[model samples]
Target: MSTSDAVTTQSPALSSEDRSARIAVTVFPLLILAAFAIAMITPDTFKPLAPGVNWALGVIMFGMGLTLTLPDFGLIVKRPLPVLVGVVAQYLIMPLVGWALCYVFGLPDAVAVGVILVGCAPGGTASNVISYLAKADVALSVTMTSISTLLAPLMTPLLTAWLVGNRMPVDGAAMDILLMVLAPVLGGFIVRFVAGKFVEKILPLLPWISVFGICYVLLVVVSGSVNKILTSGALIIAVVICHNLLGYLFG
Candidate 1:
């Protein structure tokens, strides 16, 4: 092909939605780090927000829902192999690696259980933004994230119980998971399905909303464990990094 023709056929500029996703992926982690630092320094300030952690999570999940369209889920049917592979790998690998790491480090009971919980949990909403930024299959990313999140109440509790029951009590509340994760997601989907074009107009804003919600969640989580974070923050951070890198590598 001629140079001019090749240039002309190059992909168009990123849509505003994709641009927003990239921006979110870049900014959200910085925001979380900031929140974590602030909470460690001023635990009391964020302790009051602890009660609302579930609420903040719900908001984030809802924003995730708002970005979804029925067609996104259709990717599951159209491209079943990749989708199933991603989903199964996500649910299985992360948790197993997390459980293994707990023993490797001989982690304290509380920290060990916490790591397992993190592993048992599904993919976060931010994965969609990261996938978009990485030029990965955004639709497959969303579907995997959504499916795994929907399965959390069942899978997380079961996995945690099996992996950590002897070390710590596992009282998984299905209701809490339903309220925090499922309800808002379903509500967002319903709104998008019902509002159609109107929801499209606000799609660019959803990432920011999710970012805010996640930062708030960090604040609450850190505030509740300020002393633990302050005393073992470095160790926790190391374990978390190892866990995350291993999950990605395995996945």
Candidate 2:
């Protein structure tokens, strides 16, 4: 082939990667925009969809379970101490930090509970990816996040009740929530155990599934926020930003 033709052929290949990178960059912001647009366009319509948050959470957990195996559990059994430390850190650090922010910033009751709820919640599945990107201990991170998440039904409600229950009236029946969350996860794990090769083949798409799930949850939350935003406006934004930034700093 002529040199010019060779370069021309390669140019298309290079542009494909560039296009993918651009899409990846824009996808999240676009999702955020769509979420806000939905919130504005049909706020009441999305209210009924709120229950889907729990379902989406379950699906995300199941995806996490699908990525696991017997060996992952064995790794936890083999090295209990570090895993224990990470789990403890995950539970205590985030909630306490959130509580302190509530007091320090003087957040009102409802917003304060929201902050505590997110904090009391277990480390997200995304933390494993973050740990990997940071070149930290991926296995340990996964183990800690998994164990903490598995325990979230009990721990999350309990901690939230104890800390912010008075403010927001937290229901202490965490076993119910736990069942809802873990059933899909355990089911996924069972599927992985029975069909390892099949699970492996589809594992590559799990992250995208998770991204979609997160976008759904964000939509629900933002939709809920529309009324509050309309009433409170920038003050709500300031409070939420403060809560999120503080949670990240302390988390």
Q: What lDDT does each candidate get?
A: 0.78, 0.70
- Measured on C-alpha atoms, candidate 2 has an lDDT of 0.70
Each model's backbone clash number: 0, 0
Off by over 4 Å in 1: 1-10, 124-154, 165-172
lDDT of 1 by residue, 80-165 (tens): 88877877887789889999998888899989988998888777656754564454665677667767767776778788888988
Model 2 ranges with Cα > 4 A deviation? 1-26, 124-146, 149-173
User: Which candidate comes out best when scored by TM-score?
Assistant: 1
Q: What TM-score would you give candidate 1 relative to the actual structure?
A: 0.81
Candidate 2, position 132, lDDT: 33
User: Weakest 10 consecutive residues, lDDT, candidate 2?
Assistant: 12-21
Worst 10 residues of 1 by lDDT: 166-175
Error of 1 at 218 (Å): 1.1
Per-prediction CA RMSD (Å): 3.2, 6.1
